[model samples]
Target: MKLSLKKFIKHFGVLVIGILCMSAGVALSKLSLLGTSPISSIPNVISNITAIPIGQLTIAFIFILVLLEAVVLRRQFSWQNLLQLIPGSLFGWFIDAFVRFFHSLPNQTYIEQLGLVLMGTVLLSLGVFLEVNSHAIIMPGEGLPNAIALMHQLKFAKVKVYNDFILIGISLVLALSFTHSLAGVREGTLIAAFLTGRLVNFFTEHANRFVDWMTPATDANN
Candidate 1:
């Protein structure tokens, strides 16, 4: 019941690293000119259409999800849950910074673009795995499903599928409406959706040994 400062710090550090990786992956995917991760699809499209920074839009989108969660969960939602805004803001900032950093990268050929997408997928999956394992903070993209599951007393996996469908659908509609074509949601988005979860599970199964190694003996024992 008591929290351990050391453990909390460790998980916090891991969470930051995961955010960095996820942001990098998102940036690379965008640069590839193929597609973006499903969770980022709407923000990326809106950014392109509205000229607003993707990071700023991402932060806004995440806050909206948090508000929705609060509305749905009502009494079950505690003020402490609002603390997620800090990490969400950090994530959005990182996404913006990485997008700027990768903006000049070249991906001319079809092969090169595909390679970028694949690499981005790996990074995104690894990041999600680490973030989930850390359990330090919840990304709103992930937290929305959690809130829905809690509210409906349904399975998390089922809620997650429903949430992803809703996001993809919204992104598709926005892309078509604003750009008059599919922009952010495309084949690569499908690839990421299909592979990221499997990769996360694979990494999660294999990551515990490394995590244990990094943990202090005292912490491990406890």
Candidate 2:
């Protein structure tokens, strides 16, 4: 039991940090004024349109995704999946807070902006690495797609690729319709998408030892 308790604490702590990194990554990407991840593409467009805070819009978007998950899973939707809401909420709030905090910092040059894109990508990849290792919960951004893939008996990778293209395309249409230009979908979106999976895999291979020590808990009730 002591071993289990210690493992839980360590893994939980890592999970919390991982989620924070993901939030920070999103905020940094937004601050760059270049683009954001596909998961955030729609909410970012809506935020630009409604002049609503992106974080608030993200929360709403996450709720919608969670609902989608429920719809896709139906009876298969367990409490474990429902638990995505908590982190989803925090993910939004953290994005807002991070954006507000970093809003003042300027990336005047294209190089500097690119630097942020790279940093955000690294943070995001690292976050996913740690989060998956912790085995605590899924963020709604990925959860919706995962649920869909599960239901359709499709590969998660292929589903995720299709999902991302759809998101970026939708955001492009929305931005063109209202904003008359790309608001949240840009080359950086492509950059982040292209790099994130590679980095996640890279981290998985190189950083395995850092997170391989503890395993997620299992119990009779769980």
Candidate 3:
């Protein structure tokens, strides 16, 4: 039982780390003055219109999106899925709160800029690792890509291309309609997907090692 408890704690530790990483990624997106992922983009739009923090908007948006997913994908619901939102939203809120404290330090150099990019990479990987491992509910936007892959019987990579392109188009439309700064959409969309894929791959490679290490040893003694 103690072993089980310890394992559980370890799993949760990964999750906690993952959430913090995700939050950091979000904060980086804001700092880049570029737009964010589709989910975040919609929230950004709402934030601009309402003068609300992006995190608050994202939380509310996530809730609605999850509720919609529950309705659409009833049989897919699992503890991992349902519980995931807690960490995700909490991380977002925390990052948002921290973002309030600092915009950026003045007189930063190219090395600092590189460091921020790496920070974003780490956070994106960690968040995605937790997200995939949670085996719980995936965020609606992420889930959508998976669903498309399943329905079309295609590779996730291929489906993701379609999913992201569609989202980018939608974001463009919304940005134009609302007259939000076009910089985020113009600059952020495709680059985010590419970088996120690389980061997620790194996360998965590490996770695979962890999973292998944690697998119970088999023996005939029992």
Candidate 4:
């Protein structure tokens, strides 16, 4: 679909807000001291084991996904796909900044920690929905599954689940091998994995209404 200048600006604004929310969600989840989202678990674990910043690892992980997509869908991959790096890098920086911001908050109780995880889940879901609906650029985490689904002619949802499971497995292996236990994959991660997709769908179903409400009357009339 072609976007008018007004619509393009709206979409771009939503996309940026979504990325900020997603980064904040990740930071909150980490602050909960429970676990992060499945996509971020490996990076969190590695960051803990090594001295590398999670943000830098996140960017590296995104590029690795890009490379994997190219390898698996060589015929379909284009240089345009590398454009994901732009937003992905921005997301990584946001994650670092938000993590620092949230680190100052205290989660002193189990209930408080759980609350943080739940809040993070909602923000993460809304962020994903907005980002997907914006149709601006796809994050590498999402793009990998999309590329695989297209290349294999499979369903996107199922492929996404498989992709998440693979990441969870890798996170488990890395955590166990390096940390001698599960570090970043825990109950909260499991909760996020199970609920995030459904929550995204729920938000996506209502996003149109929200956008309509946000659109100025002049734009609507035009």
Each model's C-alpha lDDT? 0.83, 0.84, 0.63, 0.84
The true-versus-predicted C-alpha distance at residue 105 of model 1, in Å, is 1.7
1-222, model 1: which lDDT tens digit per residue? 555887778788888898888888888887787788888888888987898988899899889989998998899888767878888888889888988898777799988888889989999998887777666778888887898888889999888877887888999899899899887788778888889999998886787885664455546665
Error of 1 at 16 (Å): 0.8
- Please provide TM-scores, in order, for all candidate models, with all chains considered together: 0.92, 0.92, 0.75, 0.91
lDDT tens digits by residue: candidate 4, 164-198: 99999999899899889877778889888988989
- Encode model 3's per-residue lDDT on 1-222: one tens digit a residue: 143555556556656666676777766765555566545667765665667888887788777656754665568756555654776588659668756644663216545544454565567666877766643345556765665566558797786677678767776777777775574464544456667878777767767865544343411111
Instruction: Please give, for residues 43-147, the per-residue lDDT of candidate 2 as tens digits.
Output: 888888898988898889888889989999999988888788888888889999999998887788998888888888889888888887877777887888888
Candidate no. 3 TM-score: 0.75
Error of 3 at 37 (Å): 3.3
The worst-scoring run of ten residues by lDDT in candidate 2 lies at 213-222
Give lDDT for model 2: 0.84
- Candidate 3 C-alpha error for residue 59, in Å: 0.9
Error of 1 at 85 (Å): 0.9
- Comparing 3 with 4 on lDDT, the higher-scoring candidate is 4
As for candidate 4, its clashing pairs are: none
* Candidate 1 deviant stretches above 4 angstroms: 211-222
